[model samples]
Target chain A: QQQVKQSPQSLIVQKGGISIINCAYENTAFDYFPWYQQFPGKGPALLIAIRPDVSEKKEGRFTISFNKSAKQFSLHIMDSQPGDSATYFCAASMEASYDKVIFGPGTSLSVIP
Target chain B: DAGITQSPRHKVTETGTPVTLRCHQTENHRYMYWYRQDPGHGLRLIHYSYGVKDTDKGEVSDGYSVSRSKTEDFLLTLESATSSQTSVYFCAISRVTRGEQYFGPGTRLTVT
Candidate 1:
């Protein structure tokens, strides 16, 4: 069973437009939700992360909105750029076992100029 | 980006052969993980180690084995390579204090 589920296997947005990707998890034990970005032929890098304590987190143009009650979270990119196009993965992990992170099916986003 | 390295970035092997991928980390983190990335399945955990000589299986541990004899080195071995095992494998490390995990460049294995 996939612990975390992500929607919109792929996405496309125009330059300077908003891009959004959503994810949901079934396990309530998960407390840490993080988003990772990966470029072609490269390793994934941490983009933004949010704990259940917070409703939202914003880092630069990347924002992660989390709904603790709904067991869902979404990533919003303000003014999406062509360089921002990449595969995004959402992950969930429990505080008790922080090492075990479960990832969702990635969303491939492309920004057309 | 952490101090993690995967050897033999790309490999092409015949089926039924034995293959091993090595993961070395300078981060000295207590936790190390092996994950395989497929086209539609995303990244699935194969195995993980918490300490030297301690390891555990993950969701897709079948047809694969792992060993960690030292804190910095983790090894994933395919007892007998299969065509289905052809995928990109990644290594990751995590610290207890830090709630984030860092990934290393992947190793692409192709079974022909």
Candidate 2:
């Protein structure tokens, strides 16, 4: 069973446009949600993260909007740049599980100039 | 960037052979994880260790085994490599269970 699910296996946006990727989870126990970005042939790096205590978090042009009640979260990139094109993964974890994360399928984003 | 390194960055092996990938970290993190990345499937946990000589299976532990005998070293072994086991393997570490994880560059394995 895929406890965490993500939509739009792929996406494309023009430079300076907004890019969005959505994710959902069925496990209510999940309390920690994080997003990771990966470039070709490299490891995925932490882009941003959010806890259930907050409805939204912003870091630079990256923003994570979380809806705990809806069991969903989305990543919004303002002013998307060609360099921002890469794969994004959304993950969820809880303290009960020792914080072992369950990652979503992932979304491939392409920013064209 | 996390002082994590994976050895044998690329390998080609025959089916039914045995293979091992190593993950080494210098951050002295308390938790280490082994994950395999495949097309369409994303990254799936194979195993994880919280301390030396202590390890646990993850969702896809079949056909694989792991050992963590030192604070900086974690090993993933394929008892018998299979074609399906060919994928990019990644190692991740975190200072605490709930903290952000730092991932290794990844190792790509191909089985014939």
Q: Highest TM-score, which number?
A: 2
Candidates in order have lDDT scores of: 0.90, 0.91
Residue pairs clashing, model 1: none
Q: What is the per-residue lDDT of model 2 for residues A1-113, given as tens digits with 9 covering 90 to 100?
A: 34789988999999999999999998887878999999999999989999999999999999999998899999999999999999999998885664369898999999999
lDDT of 2 by residue, B1-112 (tens): 8899999899999999999999999988878999999988888999998899989999899999999999999999999999999999999997654537789999999999
After aligning candidate 1 to the native by TM-score, how far in Å is the CA of B17 from where it should be?
Answer: 0.4
* Candidate 2 segments exceeding 4 Å error: B97-99
Residue B86 in candidate 2 has what lDDT?
94
- Native contact fraction (fnat) of model 2: 0.50
Badly placed stretches (over 4 Å) of model 1 are B97-99
- Candidate 2 accuracy as lDDT: 0.91
Interface RMS for model 2: 1.7
Docking category for candidate 1? Answer: medium
